[model samples]
Target: MNWVRGDSLGHGTFATVNIVVPANGSTFFPSPAAVKSSLSHNAGLLENEKEILSRLGSSPHIINCLGHDHTIENGVEFYNVFLEQAAGGSLADQVKKHGGSLPESFVRRCTRSIVEGLRHIHEHGFVHCDVKLQNVLVFDNGKVKIADFGLAKEKGEKHGKCECRGTPLFMSPESVNDNEYEPPADIWALGCAVVEMATGKPAWDIRDGSSIWSLLVRIGVGEELPKIPEDLSEEGKDFLGKCFVKDPTKRWSAEMLLKHPFIKVDSISFDKVHEPLSPPSPSTHFDFPHWASTVTASLPSSPYSDEWPGWSCTPESRLRRLVTDKRPENWSELDGWMRVR
Candidate 1:
C-alpha cells in the first residue's frame, strides 16, 4: 500500500490509471504497477474491481492484484487498487500498431491465450461480463492477460436492467435482448474479439455511424451471424462457427475449444522413413485419382460408427488424437493443409 504515483497510463469515465512506485524503500512488490483510483465519491466501481480480482486469485493469464490503499489530497480521500502493468499495453493498442489488423498466425496465437484465460475464469465460477480486446493486456513476453473486472459476476447471477454490464459493441445476443447472460455470453464476446484481431476492425461495422439500438436489433434477432473472414482456413472457420452458435448451450466451451484443430500446435513428420524412391528423370508426376479408387471404390459411405473410432469419450482422448495419429506421411500427401501440430 505504500507507493508513489507516477505518470498516467489512461483515464476512464470513473477512474484514472497511473503508474506506481514503492514508497520509502518499501519492498512489498519489486515490479512497477498501475494503480486505478477515483475520488471517494466515485470509488465504488474501482472498489468492486479490486474485490473481484482478489477473489479470482493469481493466474498467468489474469492480471495480478497486488493490493490497495488510500490517500488524501486537499482533504479529499481517494481509493486505489494496485494492478500488474502490461508492458506491451492493451490488445487494442497492438491492433492499432499493426495497421488495424493482425496476420492470421498472430490472431490464432493470441486467441489461444485468451481462451485459456477464459477457461480458468469460468472454472472458478465467475463470468467476465466484459470480454473485449481493450480489456486484454499484453506483457513483454507476448503473453496476454484479461483485466478490468468491475463488471464480473458469479455464475448464474441474475442481471437486472440497472446492472447491465459491458460494451455494446461486444455484447452477446442474450445480453442485448434482456440483459440476462452467463459464461456463454463471454464466449460470444471472445468470438467478436477474434474477428477484431483478424480484421483490425470491430466485429460489426460501426464506422457508418449506425444507431446502437439498430445494431443490437441485428444481433438479437438477425438470422445471420457476423461475417467470418473469407481468407481464413477451413479449420479456422470451423473454430469460429463453434463460437457463433445462436444457442448458448450449443456454443463451444473454452475447455472444448482448447482441443480444437485450429489452435492446437504440434510438429508432424511428412516423409516416410523407409519409402523407396523411383527415378525422376521423366516429367510425369504422381496422380492418385485412378489409384485412389482401388482403396475406396467398394467401401461404405459411412465406414465408421457414430463416435470417432479411435478416440474414447474423454477430454484428454480428443486432445491427444492428432498428436498420436501415426499416419503423418499419408496426411501430408493428401490435399488438406497441416499446421504445426
Candidate 2:
C-alpha cells in the first residue's frame, strides 16, 4: 500500500500535497498509497503528462501515469496523482551512489529504452522538454521508464519557451540558449543521458538548479557548457555528439542512433552486426571516464536558434497550430486523438 501522506509528501514548488496515499492498484503494501503530486493547480499543468501517458499503456521501459485527482484538505487545494512506484529509485540517485557513469554497453541499452519512450511520445505530437536521468525511474525488474511530464507540450501550442526546464547538466544546448525548440530538444537531453550513464554523474547537476532567472540569462548568452568525458570510445563520443547539437535540425533522430555501434538493444538477434562485446552487468569494468573528461564542446549552428523567450513568454510553443499529422516524423501521424485518454 503506497498511500499519500499529506503530512510528508504534499509540498512542492509546482504542487502542494499535505500527505501521500496508498496506490490503489497494488496490494503488496510496502509503503503508503502512492500519490503523484502536481507542481501546479491548473489541470492544464499536468495535461502534457496526461496526454503522453494516456497514449502509452504498460511498457517495461516507461513510467505509468495511473490517475489524478484535484481535491481539498483543510481548505488547501491540491492535485493528487496516482502513478506507478519505482522502489529501486531514480537514475540520478543511482549514478550518484555509483560515483560515475555505466559501461558503454549498459548505457547503450538504457539509452535505447529511454529513446524508445521518447519515440512513442514524439510519434504522437508531444515534446518532452525536460528529459533527464532524474526523471527516469529504474525498477527492480531492470526496466527503465520516463517520468515527469511537467515540461511537455503539444506540437505548436503557444506556451512560453522554457529556457531551463531541466537540470543544468542534463539540459540541451538549445535549452541553455533559450532557442525555439521542438522534438530534437528531447534528443539533446538524451545525449546528456548518454553522458550520465557513461560517467555515472551528470556533468553539471551540481550547479545552479535553483537560480532559474540567472541560469536563463547565462544560457541565452551562450555560457559555456561543461565538457563531457573524453575517454569514451569513438562510437560513444560520436553518438552523443549528434544529440548535443544546438540546432534542433541537426540533432540525431532516434532512428539514426539506434543503428550506432555503441547502442545495444536486446531486440536485435544474437547474430546482428556484432553482439554487445559482453552484456553490461554490475561487474563491468572501465579504465577511465569514458566520455567528457573536462573537454568543453562548442555547439553547432541553430536553424531556429534565437534567444529563448522563456517558457512564460514564448509564442506558439503550445499545441494551437499543430495538426495531428503535421510532420511525417512527428507523433500526431502515428496515433490519433484517442491517445489522450
Candidate 3:
C-alpha cells in the first residue's frame, strides 16, 4: 500500500517513528499507521525487528507489522517498516498520565495483555529480551500490545559473556550475572513492569546517585528480589512472587501467569470491572522525595566490557513532563500532514 509519512511521533537511539497515512486518499490500508525508518547503513536493527515481527505472526496482544520497504529521498536511501499505530501511546505514558501509577484492576488488564503477548512470542521459540512498560503500547480500544522487537532473540541464542541487552532496571538476575537471555528473562522484566504500574516506582529501589555497579550487584549477586508493592492485592503479590523468583527456573512462565488469579478474569468480567467511574486521583500520601528524581549513571568499563557505554535513569513522570512541555498546541490535528517522500 502506498503511504505518506507525517510528523514524527518519537525517535529513540536507533530509529524515528512517524505517523503515516494511506496515500491516494484510500482507506484500504489501516488508518493511522506508523512507519519506523532509519538510515540504510544503520537499519540492521529495524530489519531484524521486521523479521521477528513477521515470524511472530498476527496476535491481538502483539503489534501488527504491515509491511517493509526502502525509499530514497534527497539522495539518501532509507529503510522503513510500516506498523499499526497505537492511539493510546505507551503503557509508560499511561502510568504517568494517571499520576505515576495505575489502579490494580487496570494493572491486571495490562498485565494479562502482556502475558498473552509474551506467551505467543515464547511459544514461537522467541524471547522478547526487553519487556517493559515502554515497549507495551496502549490502543484506543482499551487494549495493549507488546511492541519493539529490536532486542528480541530466538530462545537459547548465545551472546558475548559481558553483553547486556535490556534496560538495566528491568534486567533479570540471570541476565545480569550469566548473560542469559531467554523466556524467563522476559518474565522477570514483566514483573518489574508490573511493579512500576502498581507502585509508580521502579521495582528495585534505585536512588538518584546509585552506581551501575551497585545496581548490577543488587540484581545479580544475591538472592534478592524486587519488593512487592504493599498496596497490591494478595493475589497480585502472589503473581509477582511467581515472576520474581531469583531462580529463573522457578519463575513462572507467561502461560502459567495467564492462569494466575491476578490476571485470570475472563474478558466479559474484565470489561465490566475495567472501566472506572472516575479517574483515580493520585495518592497524596505517596512521598516523592528528591532522591526519586531523574538520574544518569555511567557504566564503569572495568567490571563489564566496554560493549555498554552508559544508561540513563529517567523516571516516567519526568518523561511525561517533557512530552507535555514540548507538545504542540495543535498536536491533535492530523489532517494535511506532510508526506514522507
Candidate 4:
C-alpha cells in the first residue's frame, strides 16, 4: 500500500506515530490511518506489535493493525505499521480535558471496553504488559479500545533476571518483585487505570520528589494496595476490590469481571445521570496533539489535509450494528442491566 506520512502525532522512546494518507486511495485501508515508525535497526518492538495484533484478529475493543512495510526517507530505513486512528484521542487526554477525574458513568463505559479487549488478549494466551489510561484510545463515539501492544508477550513468558516491562506506576505487585507478566498483571494495572479515571491521580500517592525505588517497594514489598476512590459507586469500588487483590490466583479474570455488577449496569441510562460535561466531538479529521504516547516528548503541531475521503463506517459504528443485529433474544434480564452469558 502506497502512503504519504503527514503530521507528527507523537513519539515515544522507540517509535514515532504520524497520520498517513493512502496514496493509492485504497478502500481496504482507512484514510489518514496512524503509522508508527521506527528506525529499521530498532523496529523489533513495532514488528512484534504488528504480529501480536495480527494474531489477535479484528476486535472492536482492540486497535486494528492494517499492515506494515518498510520505507526510506532522508537516506534512513524505517519500519512502519498502519493502525486504525482513534480521533477522540487517548483516555488520558479525556481525563486531562475533564480536569483530572472523569464522570463515573464514563469511567464504567471505558473500563468495560478495556476489559473486553483484555479478555480477547488473555483468551488468546497473550498478556498486555502495559495496561494504563494512556494506552486506552477513545473513539469519537465514546467507545474505547486497547492500544499499544509493544510490551505484550505470550502468557507465562519469562523475563530475564531482574528484568521488568511496563511503567512502574502501573506494574502489578508480582511483576515488580518477581518479574512475572501474566493476565493477572493486566487486571492489576486495570485497577490502577480505574483509580486514575475516578480520582484523576496516580493509584499510588507519589508525592513530588519521590523516587522510583520507593514506589516499587510500596508495590512489591508490602501489603498496601492502591487507594480506591471514595466517590466511586459501591459496585465500582467492589469491582476494583476484585482487581486489587494481591494474590494473582485470587484476582478476578476478565470473564468474571464482565459479570460484575459494575459493568452490567444500564450504561445508556446510567450515562445520562452524570453525562460528561464536555463529551468528545465526532470528527473525521485527525486530532493528534492530545493523544499521549507511552513516553513523553515535545511534539510540533502540523495540519492534516481535509481532502481525504471519510470512512464509510467506523469500527465503533460497525460493532454497534453487529451487536444490535446479533443480540441474544434474552440479552437483557432487567431494565438498565445486561445479562452476561
Candidate 5:
C-alpha cells in the first residue's frame, strides 16, 4: 500500500516518516539499518524511543498503534511503528491560521486535550519530556493526539542528557538547568505550548536563541512574563496564566483545563468558523487528504469514500467535538495522504 503524500503534517529533527498511503503512516525514525539485516535493530536515541512508545501505547489519548512497520527488502525498508492520522492538522497550524490568537474557550479545549494526553502517558509510567504545539496533533472531529516519542521518558527512570532534542522555544527551564530531568520538566514545556497557542507565537520566539534560554530562566523563577494582548478575553489570559506557573507540579492538569471557564465561552459561530475546504496559507496547514483532494489536490471531488478509514468525527464539526465513536470496521483509509486545511 502507498500513503498519498499530501504535505508534511510534521517532521522530526531526529527522523521523519515517509507518509506512505495516509491514514496514520509509519514512524520511520528507527528505520532499518539496511535490508541486509533481518529484525534490524535501533541504536542511540531510537532505542530509548522504543521504550517510550511502548509506554505511551497504553494510553488512549495518544495515537492508536496499528503495529510496527518492520518489513524489509533488499536495500529497502518500512517504518518501525504505524499510527492513526490526525486529519484536522497540528496545533501549530491551527494557531497560526487563526490569526495567532485563538478564542479563550478554544484554547481551553486544546489545552485540555494536551494535559489529558500528558496525563495518560505519565500515568502509564512515562513522561513526554517533549510537549509543544508541534507535538500535538488535532483532528477535524475535535480529537487531539500527542506525537513525537523521541523525547519521552518513563517514570522512575533517571534523567538523561541535556542535549537539545526538543524545539528550543518550548524547552522547559528545568530541563535546561539540570542534566537529568523528570515529569515536572515536561509541565514546563506544556506551558509553552499553551502560551504559544493562545498568543500565536512561541513564548520566547521574539528573543535571540542564546538569550532566549536566559529569558526563560527569568520566567522560570516567577518573573513577570510578557504581556498577553489585552483584547484577548480575561478567561483566555487566566487559562494561559495557569499553565505559566513557575512550579511545574502546581500547574493545572489535563482534566482541570477541560473544565476551566475560559474554554467554555465559544463565539456565536465558533464551531462553524472551521469549515473544511478553507484556504490555508503558511499557517493552517493540514494533512487530511479528504480536504486536500478537493482544494489542493485539484480533484473534482473527494477521492476517498465518505465512510472510509478515517474517524467518524465529521469534518464539519471543526474538531471541537471529541471523537468518542468506537472504531470503525476498518481504519486504513487515512494511511497515506498529507493535506493542508
Candidate 6:
C-alpha cells in the first residue's frame, strides 16, 4: 500500500507506531491510521500479529487492519502494518485521565465490547493471552476494540513450562503456575481489567509493592482472588467473580460472560445499527472518562425472551437492579454467574 508516514503514535517493546496517510489522496480511510512497524531483523512478533489480524477478518469489536507493506531505510528493511486509528487512544490512557477509575456504566459497556471481541477470537480457535486495559483501544464514538495480539496463540497450544507471556498483574493462575493457558485465561485477565477499569487500580494489593514473587504466589498458590470494587453494581461484582475463578475449568468463558447481566445491560439495545460517533477533535484529546448514565438510559430495551441468558437482573434498570425473580435452575450458587451449558 502506498502511504506517507507521519508523526510517532507510541512506542512498544518491539515496534514503533506512527500515523500514516495515503499518498495518492484516495479516501480509503476517512482519517489517518496508525502503522505499527519494526526493523526486519525484529519482525517476527509484528508479522505474527499481522497474520493473526488477517485470519480474524472484519470484526466490529476487534481492531481493523487496513493493510501492510514494507519500507527500506538506510539499507534495513522494515515491515509495517496499518491499523484503524483509535482517536480516543487506549482504555489505560482513559482510565488515567479519569483519575484512575472510569464509571461503572462505562466500564460495563467497554467490557461488553471486549467480551464480544473475545468471543470472536475464541470462536475462531485463538486465545488472546493478553487481555488488559492497555490493549483495549477506544474510538471517539465511545466504542472499544481489542488490540495487540502478539502473544495470542491457538487453543490447546503448549508453551515453555516456565515462560510467561502477559503482564503479571493481569496474569491468570494457570499462567503464573504452569505457563499453560487457554481462552479461559483471557477471561481471568478480563476480570482484572474490569477491576482496574472500575477502581482505577490494579486488581491486587501487590501492584504498588516490589514483590513479584509474593504476587505470583498469591495468584497461583493461594486461594485468594483479586478484590472487586465495592462501588460496582451487584451484576458487575458477580461478573468479575465468574472471571476470577481459581479453576480455569469453572471460570466463565467469553461466550458465557457475554450472557452475564453486566454485559446484557449494555446489550439491551446495542444490536441495532447505529452510525458510529464522530471522532473527537485531535486538538482536544481527553484521556479516559466515559459517557454518563444519561446516554445509556436513552437506549430502548430490546425485545428479548424472558428466558434470555442473564435476564434475571433486568427491569431496564441499567445493570444496577437486583435479581428479584428466581434464578434459572442452571445458575451457579458459588458466584451467582449463569452457567452456560
Q: Score each candidate by Cα lDDT.
A: 0.65, 0.52, 0.73, 0.71, 0.49, 0.69
TM-score winner between 2 and 6, please give it: 6
Rank list by lDDT: 3, 4, 6, 1, 2, 5
TM-score of each: 0.76, 0.64, 0.81, 0.79, 0.63, 0.77
Per-candidate RMSD, Å: 22.2, 13.2, 7.8, 15.2, 15.0, 18.2
- Give per-candidate clash totals: 3, 59, 0, 0, 22, 3
Clashing pairs in 3: none
Put down candidate 3 lDDT per residue, 220-289, tens digits, no spaces.
Answer: 9977789999999999999999999988998889999988988986631345333322221111112322
User: Which digits, one per residue and each the tens of the lDDT, describe model 2 over residues 1-341?
Assistant: 23434333212223432223344454543343345444234445555566667766666666776666565544546555666655445666555545655655556667777888887777777777767665676655556778767567775654344323444444555655654446787887788677767776554433422343443344455535545678788877877777766567777887677776666554322222131222112111122211110101222122122222111211232222122332211111112111111
Best by TM-score: 3
Clashing pairs in 4: none
lDDT of 1: 0.65
Candidate no. 1 TM-score: 0.76
Over 62-158, each residue of candidate 4 has an lDDT whose tens digit, in order, gives: 9999888888765768898988887767787777777777888788878888999999999999998878877788765667899888778999777
Off by over 4 Å in 4: 265-341
Instruction: Decide which is better by TM-score, 1 or 2.
Output: 1
lDDT of 1 by residue, 1-341 (tens): 46777666665434667777777677886586777767667576577778888888888889999888888844657787888887677777777666677677777777887888899999989988778777788776667789877777789887446333565567788876777668898899898889888886666654333545566677889676877887877887898899988888899999998888777754112121132222111111111010000000011122121122210122343235335563211101112211110
Query: Candidates 1 and 5: which is better by lDDT?
Result: 1
Candidate 3 off by > 4 Å: 26-28, 267-269, 272-341
lDDT of 4 at 58: 86
Winning model by lDDT: 3
lDDT of 2 at 74: 41
Which of candidates 2 and 6 reaches a greater lDDT? 6
- Candidate 5 residue runs with Cα over 4 Å from true position: 1-14, 22-50, 58-60, 73-79, 160-165, 208-229, 253-259, 263-274, 277-341
Ranking by TM-score: 3, 4, 6, 1, 2, 5
